[model samples]
Target: MARQDTPTNEMSLRWTVCGDRDVTVRGAEPGDVSALRRFIDGLSRESRYFRFLSGGQVGDAVVSRVLGRHDGRDIALVVTDGEEVVANAVYVVNDADEAEFAVVVADAWQGRGLGRRLIQHLQQLARAAGLRGMRGDVLSENRRMLAIVRELGFSTRRAPGDAYVQEVSLRLAAVTREAWLAHDWFQG
Candidate 1:
């Protein structure tokens, strides 16, 4: 099978959160380095740790390196609100034809369903790129995240050698885009 190239065209998903707030999630660009930095720096200490899986200052050097490769490849997506990034998600494809994913939503934006939207968008992008599956490692304490992935058809297991971490994976081939999007969290 011929390997598929990463998606190149730009697609924007606009959604209204909290009934009155509007936001947009789209492909992360190289110019987003500074904005990305601000977004990371704005994350509460706990949020940063949850996203990075460790506790330490997320420095410019690290942000720059991350954006360096996020230039329209490897599936990087960000949700922006009026000028700042409120959420970020990415899924890097591996040799096994699966993409390892992660998502971080701003503390203030938590509980508004931003993380789920970001992951769903990332899955769409990855599936379009021919990835067979998507997976993420979540800290055991993050019950909300675990529940979200489970509701999206991802199966979870204890990460080998790490009891505190849960490895969750979804078989992208089994989910049709229409069906996936139809599982909208906005529905009451």
Candidate 2:
């Protein structure tokens, strides 16, 4: 996949998950820093460590980085339930043509499909940006996330230099279920 001038600025839209429930899913806006911080700070300690791999709060610079202030090639998404930020997901395209990703869902939002849906959305955005693949690093104990990505067609291996982390990756160009499922609208 070669880089093209594809616009990945997904418009803010209210998404109806099933037939009755509605959720606002949109690109991470500059004004969302406080909400994003609240979402992260509201997560359980275990979840925060799993998402950031650190006990310290993520600095404002990194938050702005993911919010795409430094690079438009990167993408971040926000999921809100009414006025509360419920989830955040992002992908940074590295020089290797692989989009490395990170996703976190609020404590109460766990067990729901928000994480999976956000990952699928990230995959679509990465594909449109001509990224060859998407990958993420998860703790060995994060069985839930491992299961989600595996079910979505990602394969995992032990991360180099780290015994407790698993590196999961999915090739976007491959003919796979997620590809069609995520972009079924134009898959002719």
lDDT of 2 by residue, 27-130 (tens): 88888988887777787888888898875687777666657643768888888888898888888888899999999888887876778888887888889888
lDDT for position 164 in model 1:
93
Give the TM-score (vs. native) of candidate 1.
0.82
In model 2, pairs of residues that clash are: none
Local accuracy of candidate 1 as per-residue lDDT tens digits, 17-69: 86677777677788999899989988898898888866678877767655536
Worst 10 residues of 2 by lDDT: 1-10
Query: What lDDT would candidate 2 get against the real structure?
Result: 0.81
lDDT of each: 0.80, 0.81
The reply for model 2, stretches above 4 Å from the true place, is 1-10, 17-20, 174-188
Q: Could you estimate the TM-score for every candidate? A: 0.82, 0.81
Off by over 4 Å in 1: 1-9, 68-73, 174-188
Error (Å) of candidate 2 at residue 141 is 0.8
